[model samples]
Structure formats: structure tokens, C-alpha cells
Target: MTLLKAKSILSKDFRIGRASDRLFGSFVEHMGSVVYNGIYEPDHEAADEDGFRKDVLELVRELKLSVVRYPGGNFSSGYNWEDGVGPKERRPVKLDLAWRQVEPNSFGLDEFMRWTGKVGADAIMTVNLGTRGIDEARNLLEYCNFPGGSQYSDLRRSHGVRDPYKIKTWCLGNELDGEWQIARKTADEYGRLACETAKAMKWVDPDIELVAVGSSARHMPTFPEWDRTVLMHTYEHVEQLSLHHYIGKRENDTPTFLAMPLEMEQQIKDVIATCDYVQSVKRSSKRMKLSFDEWNVWREPDVPYTPWQTGCPYDWVKFHMEDALVFGSALLSILRHADRIDIACQSLLVNTIPMILTNKGGAAWRNPTFYPFLHASRYGRGEVLRLETESPKYDTKLYTDVAKVDSVAVWNEEKGELTVFAVNRSEESIAYELDIRDFGNVSFAEHLVMNHERLDAVNTADNQGEVRPRAGGTTTLNGGRAESVLPPYSWNVVRFNVQSA
Candidate 1:
């Protein structure tokens, strides 16, 4: 009977909250082929009129991304925002130590803004809190958002941008604690600098929002202390505290790797406590949120580093099938924490550990992770509903046997539908029956599954259709529950027409 069974959840009210309120966004850095060929492939057939790849743009648009963090991951630590502002031909070339690549200075601030505009998203710009300090940050703010007057604003106008970008979201720094990070600073140093910088940047544009650096990851030895100290210094000055965490499937065990999102839940919980603690200590009622700026299932098997080698830092790293499954779990985890995680960007947008990868002079394809992101971003809006599932488990050395079922339900108040994204990590398929008590009656539309036989299957530019999310089957129901078979190692999205249900 395929071990199918029904589990009645008596008080099964949907854990309804805004998923978009939690948000889905991505970052794009200057390293690797992310530039030059990734997002800016001029010679490709898919290239748009502005030189941005049309194929990649369509994929990004499909991801339903609300925000796009610009021009830096680690790149911001060393970037000087002014170099690429004026006439393109007059810009000066410089060395970008973050990625060990030469800065052509062709695709600068203006280009990035235009790209964000084309992508139908808002820009989340990062300030160089490293080598360049407050004055540089303020100048960039005035240049992008200031209307006129002063040298920088006038230079922006002379550059033909009559209007200021006025980007309101700003990141104070990117991973300031890492030794590899350019101009890394001590917690105290970063704290003082952040406070002063936030204060000054606000002076330039008070409407702008600021984020302070949280620990690079939870395991960082300085962790809670770093967060406490930074918040102590800058809590009152900033609106959000940024956290960056990345997971990997290095174990080669699908179940354990899929368990990562649940683990991330714990880490996010800790960060939340830390923030509340700081808020309590400072005796401030104003709540602060989290920005998970860098995240995703990155498959960088190994790092072969030759200090400042004469080559790009990221050469040809791309994501595969299983990686995307893990990515779905990560997005599910983000939904679970929708209330506190105010801003989240999928590590990157194009190339350099991106959600979308492109090849110059050829077509580009969506990474295996793209479908999950696309499905959820397009439908994971409105109120997020909490789901409860029970299944058999498997044990691994790192983490014990985990539940085979994981799910996040989104109730789109705007569209009046419910999308239940479930990741069945079990090796064997399981037919499950669900009853959503909140929706007394509704119709199930589709059950799309992102699955394939080989764990390593990938999408290439030539055979882009080799892997993708295809239309799923669903019951034309007039009932109170939803039923579906969640395939092994797959992510499933069950869409329900629950407008008034």
C-alpha cells in the first residue's frame, strides 16, 4: 500500500504569516565570472539591449526576487565606490584583492543600479567599512541618493543621471571578522566604526536603513561576544543586524545534508536570543531584525589557494541537482523564521556561487537550485503557515536520524492560495495525507516536484532543459485535506486554491 497513511492534526491551524515579509533576495559579487561573463555577457545571444543577459534576467525574474544585493560579497570590503561613477571611458582600473582579479571599472555603480532596475528589484548596497571609511560612505550615499549640490552629487548629475538612486538599504560591512576579508578589524574597532559610520551615513540620508555585521557564522570563536559587542556599540544606531551562513553537502549523505535547514533554524534562534539579550540590556524597546545576506548550498569541494595567484578566485564552480534540493530546504528554513528574518538574499544572483550561471558567447542555464527558488519566490508570499509532519528517520554520525518530512506552507493573501513546499529527505518514497484545519475546504491545483535520478545531474548552457521543474499533477478536490506522494530526495510544492478556505 506504499505505506500511505492519514494523520489527523486536530488543531492544525496554518502557521500563517507573511513569507515575503520574511523575503527572498540574492547577492552578486565582482569575483569570478560573475561579472565580465556571468551577468554582463555582451556577446551572448541572450544579451539584452543593456548588455545584461536576457536569459539570466528571465531566470532571476522568475525567482521573484524582491531585492538584489549589489557588487560585493567580500568584494565590498575592498571596493571604492567612486572609481566607476563617471564617463565609462575615463574610469581608472584598479586591483581588486578580494577576488584576485583586475577591476576593469567598466561595470561600476551606475551599471549595477541599472542592472537592478532591469531585474525589477531594489538595490541593497554595501559600504566599504574597511580601507575607506565614513567620508567615502557618505559621499557614495549622496552620489546615489542626493539630488544636487556638492562635488559627488554634481558629478553624478554630470554623468547624466538627473535623478538620484536613493537606495535606502545599506550594509555596513561584509564579514568583517574574517582574516581573509579585506581590512578585517577587531570587534571593538568594527563596533566603534559602525556606530560612527551609521550616524554619519544617516546624516547624509536619514531615510536610509543600516545593517551591522553579525558574526560571520555561528561557530566563529568570537561569536556571541562579537554580536554583543557590536550591538552594544551600534544597536541604537542601526536598524538591522546582518548574519551570513552557508551550508554544504560535503558528507555526501542526502538525508543529513537536507537536515541543514533545521540546523540553521537553531542557529537563527541563537542569534535571535542574542539580539533580544542586547536589546534587553540596552533597555531599548525598538526591535532589530536579521539580514541573512550570504547563504545557499555551495558545492566548493576544495579550496586550492596560492596566495594572490595570477588567476580569478572562483574559476568554474557550479551547483548540481542535490545541491538544489538542499537549497529548497534552506528556503523552507527561512520561511520557518519569517517573523524575525526581515531580509534574506540567496548568496548570489549570477555566477560565482550563483543561483543562475551563464557562459559568454553562449546560452545560460538555471542552477538546479533555481526551481525551488523560483517556485517559492513566485508563490511563497502572504501568510506563512506552519506544518507538522511525521515520518521514519535515518541516522548519521554528524546528526541523528532526522524526520523524513519537512515543509513550509505559504498563504498568499494577495492571490488567495496556499503553496506547501515539502522536502522528503527519505531514501524511499512515502505517500502522505494532510489535513489543513485552517482551510476547511479548498481545491488542490498542482504538485510540482524537483527531482532526478542522479544526485550529480546538472544544467548546462546547451542542454538547459536537461533538468527543470515541470508541471505537477494534483487532485481536483473539494475537501479539507491535501494528499500527495513526496518522492525520495525531492522538494515538492503543492499549490491549493484556498482563497476563502
Candidate 2:
């Protein structure tokens, strides 16, 4: 097979920005088994004192998540924070109209905070804005962040939580623009409500950062217009705007599927443009950041369950190797825009299209998507180095000049390390070259690759290692230059120790 060629140059002076730790965030919603058998199962043999599954916790810890958005997605729109607090027995059981499931109220506010503490992640709490508005939003903020003296704070103390949870990040609401959302609102309505709710919540706890709801998906008919209107209304009050998107395979086209990140990258740039436009309109110096709080490769499951069933099994997708490649490329897209995207959460952390899956009373296992997220979360930190690349290109039905090699680099000054993340989208191996400049002497560490002969290969509880990453790829470094042969249809991570001459 003839080798395709790709070259990239990286220098210390060319930096986008320091990657935010919160860029490695993941989300956990009260949908499906994600809350019940997924993370909190009392009867499991590996269950901890708090009823959280220790085996699952072990996997979550490995991801090194910076923040875990709690009790939401669409769930928060209809959620009543009061329903999930105090004693588990006394808490009210309600019909969750979001996913058409019954919420037992067994695990609520306090439980999620404790779970985040156990996993060593900060909480990005979402308040109810659909069914309830500013009052309920402020009340939940007080319940979580206030140090007594008020009704909600005293109520929290009465529940045996003496000190406040002090959650620093707050999402005003979830996708309120989607018609599928429980009390979905128009852009004007959501913006006014989000703005006022942000005001009251900050009044309750002045230290919290607020994220206003932007367009739920890029293809929404109201897209950039919705974002613009919402920002125009709430820009002064909020710190960040929220965006959610999910990509999936299209008609068995592997090349087009791998090129999906082009869409993602474009969407990020468009949203940033809208935010900046809003800033220019207001003539304000406050530049708004973004929270890509919900993102993943979602393929709706064929699995079925009766309506109103508590802890119902739903949308448990076993991701394949091809999915992981696209997923890792999506991470690279996010890393490339680290200056604007301050926070990102892979939606539904367990069971419902998650990285890790658990068998009700049995074992916990990883999906093929787990390893890419693991590698990115573990090594894709520090300053993002902008790379200039030249590679063989192909045109897909939706994209033109799509690079056969998708890649990004991160330079960790403190650790004296440089990490390169690359993906080979073509079915033929590529001869890759890296020209390092101004970083002085650097030594190659290891090349980790994830490639499978079968595009549809998956991992299950019984066979967890069926499609994991391994140390492979032929790579060598000399005189500030590196060369490697990237495998066909693979996800690669290369590391190097940097020293100044």
C-alpha cells in the first residue's frame, strides 16, 4: 500500500490559550438507569456506605472529570428541587414528563452533591426554569449555597446538612428551545426568565457563575438568531451561554461519519461569532464564554420500556470503535477552541449513551468510547498549541477538502510535556511528520493507538478489553523533528518530554 503524507508544525509561541480544567467535564442526568442502577444502587455488592457503586466510581475517577453537571439535561426543566431533598422515604414521587419515566425521588439534590464529592468533581447545578421560574431558581440556589438564616437554607440545615454545598457553577435551564422539552419556551420568553433568574440566584449567592440557555442544537431553525436574541437579553447578567449537540453515523458512510467534527468545529466558531456580535451590539467589554455542556455521539437505542417505570432501562448504546474515533476527533475540535469554550460535558455519563455502563446487580464495564475520553482527559491538558498542517484531502458529500489526518497539540509548560492527538480518517496508512520549533530539545515518549479491524466492534461487561487502546505505531524523534506511520482508521496520542537547550 502506498503511504499518504501529512505534516504539522508546532511552536511554543503559537498558543491558543490555557485549556480550562472544566473542559474535561461530564454530565449525569436523572434519566433512565443513570441515576438508579447506573450510579446509585443500594443492593449491589460493590455499593458504598452512601449507596453509590464503588466499581463505577473507580471508572469515573479514572476520567479525571473537572465538573459533573447534575440532575439535568431535560430533566431539570420539569424538576422540582424540593422533591429530591431531605429524607428519601418522605420525598414525593412524580412523573418525569421529560423522558416519560417515573422519578422515585429516592436520589435527589443532597445525594448528587455527595456523589460529586466522592468522585472529586465540582457540581454544575441546573435549576428548574420551565415549570418553575425565578422564585424556584433562587430557592434552589439558597438551599445549596446559603449558610442558613432563610427558609430554604434553614430547611437545608433541618435536613441535617449544616454547611452549604457552595456550588460555584449554575446552569439556568436546559434546552428550553426544543419543542420536545417539558415546558419549552420561545427565545424571548426563555431569555427574560433566564436573565431574571440569574439576577435572583446571584443575589442569593453572589459568587456563582451563570450559564444562559443558547440554541439546543446547531440545526435548530432558530439557531444563531436564538443565540443572538438570548444573549441580547441576558448578556449583562450571565457569564456563559450553553450549547448542546450530538452527532451520529449517517447511512454507513465511514468517511463522512469521521468528518463530522468539521460540523462541530464550524458550530463552535459560529456561536462564538454570535456571542461576539452581541458584545459588539451592546458595546460592552464583558466577553462571554461558552459552555458546550451537552455533547456526544448519540444513536437512539431500539430498546423499549414501559412508560412511568422507575429506573427504566433506556438508550443504552454500546459504542463501537468507529464511534470512538469520531468522538476523539470531537474532543480535538473542542481543544482547538479552548479560548472560548470554558466548559464541556459529555452528556449522560452512564447507561443512557454513556462512556461506562453497569449491569443492574452485576458488573460495571466500559464502552469503546471510554478510552478516547480517558486519553484526552488524562493528557489533553495545559495550553493548546495551534498547529499549521498540510495533508492529503478528500471531499465528502457535506464537506470539502476534509483532511485525511485530524490532529491537535497541547503544551504543558509546568509538566514540561507536549502531547499530540491525531486521527487517521482514511483506510490507508499515512506517513506523519511533526516539526517542533522553539521548544529546544524534546524526546518522544510513547505512541498510543486505538484501531480495530471491524468498524462495528463493541465491548460488553464480559469482554471489557475487546476494543481498548494499546502502545503501537512506528514513531521516532531526532533534532526537533518526529516521524510516524499512522495506522488506517485509528485514533492516536503521542507524548514527548520537552527540555530547553
Candidate 3:
């Protein structure tokens, strides 16, 4: 077998931007077992004092998530924040129209906040802009952030806590442009409502940053226009605009599926262009950032679940090794645009196409997709270095001249470390070279690779280690240059310790 060749030139001076810790975020929605058996299970053997699963929390802590979006996805659009605050017994049990399930309200705002605190992550709360509006949004803001004296603040104080939650980041709404959304709005209508809600919420707590809803996905007919119109209205009030993308295999087309991140990269660029267009239109100097809050590989058909049942098993699709490759590439795409994208949450943290899966009263296991996220969250921090690469290219059904090797580099200036994340999209091993420049003396530290012969390999509760990362790949560094062999259909992490000459 012949080896494909790839090389990337990296310099210390060339930088994209300092990667935001919030970029390594995850989402937790009230949908399905994501909230119930997913994270909160009182009967679980590993239950904590707060009723959150200690086993799950251990995994979450290991993931090193910086921030978590709460009570949402589509659920925030129809949810009433008030219902989720008070005592558990008094909390109302309502039908979740969004996902066609019952919401017991047992795990509400306070519980979520506590859970986030325990896991050492900040909260990005979303308000209900579909079934509700400005007043409710401001009230929820007041309840969470206000110190005291106001009705909502005092109400929060009466619950048990005297201190304010003071969550700084917020999402104005979910995907309101989708027809499936509870109160799906026209672009103009959503723009107006979002602007007003943002204004009122800011009036209540000026410190909070707002993320206005953008189009649900790039394929939405209203796409760039929807983002433009929304930004046109909410530009001054909000700090970031939200974008969601979920990649999946189409007709067993692995090449096409892996190339989907190219689409994701373009979507980020298009949204940035839209934001700039809106900025010019408004003549506003404030540049709008983006929050890619909902993203993952979701391709499972809807599974059957009893209606109105608590902790119903839903969307428990086990991710395969092929899925992890796409997931890793998608993450690299996000990292490449770290300058403009402020926050990103991999859809659901626990079940529902998640990195981790849990049984109702059994064990919690890592999915194949977990390793890429884990590697990125752990080492893919600090400055994103600009890499000029030349790699062997191949043509896919949907993409032309697709690079066999896709890669990105991150330099942790403080830690004196430079890390390179690369993916081999081809079925053959690639001889890769790192053309290090400008940085002083450096030595290869480690190389972690994830590769499995079976693309459909998955980890179950019984065999938790069916698919995982291993220390492999031959890498050596000498005189500001490194050489490594990337395995076929693999995700590789190459780290180097930078030293001053």
C-alpha cells in the first residue's frame, strides 16, 4: 500500500485568535431521558446528595466542559421558567409539546444551576420566546440575577437561596424559524420579538450577554436572510447569534458524511458575512460574535416511547467510530473559526445523540464520539494557530479535491505547548509532516489516535471499552520539524513541548 503525503507549516506569530473555553461547551435539554435517567436519577446506585448521578458527574468532569446550555433545544420555546423554579412537589407536570413527552419539572432551573456548579461549568440559559414574550423573559432574568427587593428576586430568595445565580450568557430563543417549532415565527416576527425581549432582559440585567437565534441549519430556505434580519433587529442588544448544525451519514456515504464539516465551515463563514452585512447596515461598530450552541452527529430514526411517561427512553442512538471521525472534524471546523465563534455546545450531554450514555438503574458508558470531544476539551485550548497545509486530495461524490488529511493547531503560550489535531479522511495511512517555524526549540510530547477497523463499532453498557482512544502513531520531532504516520480513517492528536532557544 502506498502512503499519501501531507504537510502543515505552523508559526508562533500567525494566530487565528485565543480559543474561548466556552467553545468546549455541551447542552442539556429537558427532552427524553436527558434530564431524568440521563443526569438525574435518585434511585441510581451512584446518586449524589443533589440526586444527580455521581457516575455521570465523573464523566462530565472528565470532559472538562466550560459552559452548559440549559432547559432547551426546542423545549425553551414552550417552557415556562416559573414552573421550573419552586418546590419539587408543587412543580407542575406538563406535557412537553416540543418532544411529545411529559415534563415533571422535578429538575428545574435551580437544580440545573446546582448541577452546573457541581460540574464546574457556567450556565447559558435560554428564555421562552415562542409561547411567551418580553415580560416573562425579563421576569426570569430578574429571578436569576437580581439581588433582592424586586418581586422576582424576593421570590427566588424565598425559595431557599439568598444569593443571585447571576448567569451571564443567555439565548433569546431556539430555532423559531422551523415549522416544527411550537410557535414558529416569520423572520420579521422573530426579529421583532427577539429584539424586544433582549431589550427588556437587558434592562433587567445589563451584564448578561444575549445570543439571538439564527437559522436552525444551513439548508433552511430562510438561512442567511433569517440571520441577517434577526441581526438587523437585535444587533445592538445581543452579543452573539446562535447557529445549529447536525451532520449524519447519508446512504452509507462515509466520504460525503466526513466532508460535511466543509459545509459547517462555510456556514460559519456565511453567518459571519451576514453579521458583518448587518453591522454595515446598522452602521454599528460592535462586531457580533456567534454561539454554535446546538451541534452533533444525529441520524437515528425516531424511536418509540410511551406518551407522557417520565424518563422515557428516546434518541438513544449509539454513535459509531465513523461518527467520531465526522464529529472530530466538525470540532476542528469550529476551532478554526475560534475568532468569531464564542460558544458551542455539542447537542445533548447525556442521552439523545450524546457523548455519554446511561442506563436507567445501570452503568454509564462512553460513546465513540466521546473521545474526540474529550481530547478537544482537554488539550484544544489557548490560541488557534494558522496552519498552511498541502495534502493529497481526493474527490468525493459531493466534494472536490477533498484533502485526505484535515488538521488544525493550537498553541498554549502559557503552557509552552503546541498541539495539532489531524484527521485522515482516506482509507490508507498517510505520512504526515509538521513544518514547525518561528516557534523556538520544540520536542514531540505525545500522539493519541482513535482508529477502529469496523466503522460501525460502538460501546455498550456491558462492553464500555469497545471503542476508545489509544496511544499510537509514530511521531518524532527534531529542529522545529516533526514527522508522523496517520492511520487510515483515524483521528490523531500530536502534541509538542515548546522551549525557548
Model 1 C-alpha RMSD to native: 2.4
Which is the winner by TM-score between candidate 1 and candidate 3?
3
Q: Residue by residue across 1-501, what tens digits does model 2's lDDT show?
A: 668999999999999998999999999998888989999999999999999999999999999999999889889988999989998889888999998998989898999989999999999999888999998988888888899999999999999999999999999998999999989999999998988888888888888999999998999998989999999899999999998879987777889999998888999999999999999999999999999999899775746666788887788888888989999899899999999999999987999889998889999999988898898898888999999999999998888899999999999988898999999999999989999856888888899989999988989888989998999668988788898888999999998999855
Sum up the clashes in candidate 2.
0
For residues 1-501, could you state the per-residue lDDT of candidate 1 as single tens digits? 455332323222456456653367888888767777778866778778767787777877777678888777788988988887887788888888887777877888898888888888899999999888898889899898899988889989998899999897999988899888999999999999999999999988899999999999877897878988999999999988988778866666766787776667778888899999999998999888888888877777223433343223363555777778878888888888887888998877776667777655766777788788888777887777666666676677677757677777777756767677877777677666677656665677888887788877888767776667767644334357656777777778888776553
lDDT of 2 at 14: 97
TM-score of each: 0.94, 0.98, 0.98
Candidate that would win on lDDT: 3
Q: Show how many residue pairs clash in every candidate, following the order shown.
A: 6, 0, 0
By lDDT, is 1 or 3 better? 3
Q: RMSD for each model, in Å, please?
A: 2.4, 1.1, 1.2
Off by over 4 Å in 3: 301-303
Error of 2 at 436 (Å): 1.0
Lowest summed lDDT window (length 10), candidate 3: 299-308
